[model samples]
Target: MKIFGLTGWSGSGKTTLAVKLLPALIGRGLRVSTIKHAHKGFDIDHPGKDSHNHRMAGATEVLVSSPKRWALMHELRDEPEPTLEELVRKLQPVDLLLIEGFKRDRHPKLEVWRPSVGKPLIAAEDPTVVAIASDGPVPDARVPVFHIDDAEAMAAFVVEFCGLRA
Candidate 1:
């Protein structure tokens, strides 16, 4: 799959941009999948659910299935966190893979920035950040800057940048 990324600091609207970009890419007839990285502990299971119970009982991997969907939850009990590429290998192929929040990964990324967040731009230090999407003008950024609300234009830029048609 073609890999691209969206990275930014906390409260910079990376998740919001990812959600907007999803439909824009899908509307263009591309099969797009996303991987969202969380910096903290997260739980997809409820305390009383069988899957949760299984996990609490020390099951390493718990797969919960129903008619509409299936989810596989793997416990990284003692293993080191997997690399982005390692995670990619586990997914089915797609036209695009939108990775959110792996700011340190070397893959090309669009830095989502909000000046109000008061964080420095990652693109300034990371050459892997190919573009910036900001809530305000970033005149000095070396890469192309897009208005955060302009998902269609950003989608076009991503499609061409990744050579999706090629």
Candidate 2:
């Protein structure tokens, strides 16, 4: 599967744009999958649940299955965080893979920029940034710039850049 990424400083609308792009891409008949990296510890398991109990009892990996879906939660208790590539291999193939975060990884990414955040622009130094979605005019941007609210345009850019077919 082809890969593209959405990245930006916190509060810069990366998730918002991803939410908009999902249906846009899917409407074109593409099967889409997403991988998101969380900077802080987050848990999908709830206390009192069997799966949760298994994890708390020091199971390194817990696989919960049902008629509808199966979820595998791997606990890296003392292991290093897996690289982006490592995580990608765990995902089932799809027409497109949209990754959020892992900004330091070498992948084509669209930077969602908001000047008001008062943070330095990541695209300024990251050559992997193929395009930018900004809240305002960015005449100095090194790559194509689209209005942050223009989900259709951004989605089109991604499909073209990744050479994706519907």
Among these predicted structures, which one has the highest TM-score?
1
Residue-level lDDT tens digits of model 2 in 1-166:
9999999999898899999999989988889999998999999999999999999999999999999999999999989999999999999999999999999999999999998987888998999999999988775788999998888888888888888886
Worst 10 contiguous positions by lDDT, candidate 2: 133-142
Model 2 ranges with Cα > 4 A deviation: none
TM-score of 1: 0.97
RMSD of each: 1.0, 1.0
Task: Give lDDT per model, in order.
Answer: 0.94, 0.92
Off by over 4 Å in 1: none
The number of the candidate with the highest lDDT is 1
User: What are the TM-scores, per candidate, against the unseen true structure?
Assistant: 0.97, 0.96
Each model's number of backbone clashes?
0, 0
